[model samples]
Target: MRWEFGSILPPEVKYNLCEPEILWFNKYSKCLANYMKSIGDNHGLNLTQDSKPPKSLYIEVRCLVDYGKFELDDGESILLKKNSQHLLPRAQCEPLIRQGILQHITQ
Candidate 1:
């Protein structure tokens, strides 16, 4: 409730749970992948075909003593650590991107 409408919102408050909103990110990620690859191809840089599975990004609870946005579902979930990282690198994102790999993004 600390955020105002249309304001440049800062990071979520401590202990903020963003998993509920993850669906949005999931869709966005796929779309973003497509857009990024297309742009790369248009520029003659995206043409590599990555068959690896996408990576999942989540927060490590045990590590964060403050607030967290994601919860890792790796077996027994842990609490958010203060120094937690929310973004997991897409394993195939860079290599394929750098190799100019392109594929039809599907839902």
Candidate 2:
């Protein structure tokens, strides 16, 4: 039941994912995707769709601040540092890119 690389919801960790929103972040996912979908429907939040931007972009960090760690789609945790370059979904990195913390690198 080990999770494969790039898996956000691995089989073993699936059942252990849920947590109380107030204690953790308001984010959540259920063991049963259908049930989660139904709950989202009741709450008016669509769970099934391409939530990220269609296009991704590569970026290079420019500042010395730690932008925190990001779990990449490839199942790697990156501690973004100055002069580090990474490819990330635009939607996910938009804020940092806008704040001058990261500079876009044309591919």
Candidate 3:
């Protein structure tokens, strides 16, 4: 609903929802907004915008902190040391990037 209608729901949809549902939707929207505002060194990222598959399978990233011993889905482990740069699988490194442990290096 948020993706289609943005933060505010249309009047037609809002009118149909019960009070609890409305409240829940509002709370959820607020939470999502808050999270989006917190990404990327306080610069913020709009996750909802350009919602599509990545153009590439891998992304270059820099470690923001010493996360240490990250395991891949293929059972390989790699050390994530601060100030180090790596080309990592996007799927596996997304959470780390979101948490600010890794910085995505975009061209």
Leading candidate by lDDT: 3
Output the lDDT of residue 9, model 2.
51
Q: Model 1 over residues 1-107: C-alpha lDDT tens digits?
A: 21131112246532353765545545655565566567733533322333344444321112224533433323444334455433322432343224433222323
Clashing pairs in 2: none
Q: 1-107, model 3: which lDDT tens digit per residue?
A: 88788899999999999999999998989999999999945757678865896899799999999899999877999999999999888867888988999999989
Q: Could you say which candidate leads in TM-score? A: 3
Q: List TM-score per model, in order.
A: 0.24, 0.36, 0.59
C-alpha RMSD values across all candidates: 18.8, 14.2, 9.6
Note the clash tally of each candidate.
20, 0, 0
Q: Say what the RMSD of model 3 is.
A: 9.6
Q: Of the candidates numbered 1 and 2, which has the greater TM-score value?
A: 2
Q: List candidate 2 stretches off by more than 4 Å.
A: 1-65, 71-76
What lDDT is reached at residue 60 by model 1? 16
Q: Identify the runs in model 1 with alpha carbons over 4 angstroms from their true place.
A: 1-20, 42-107
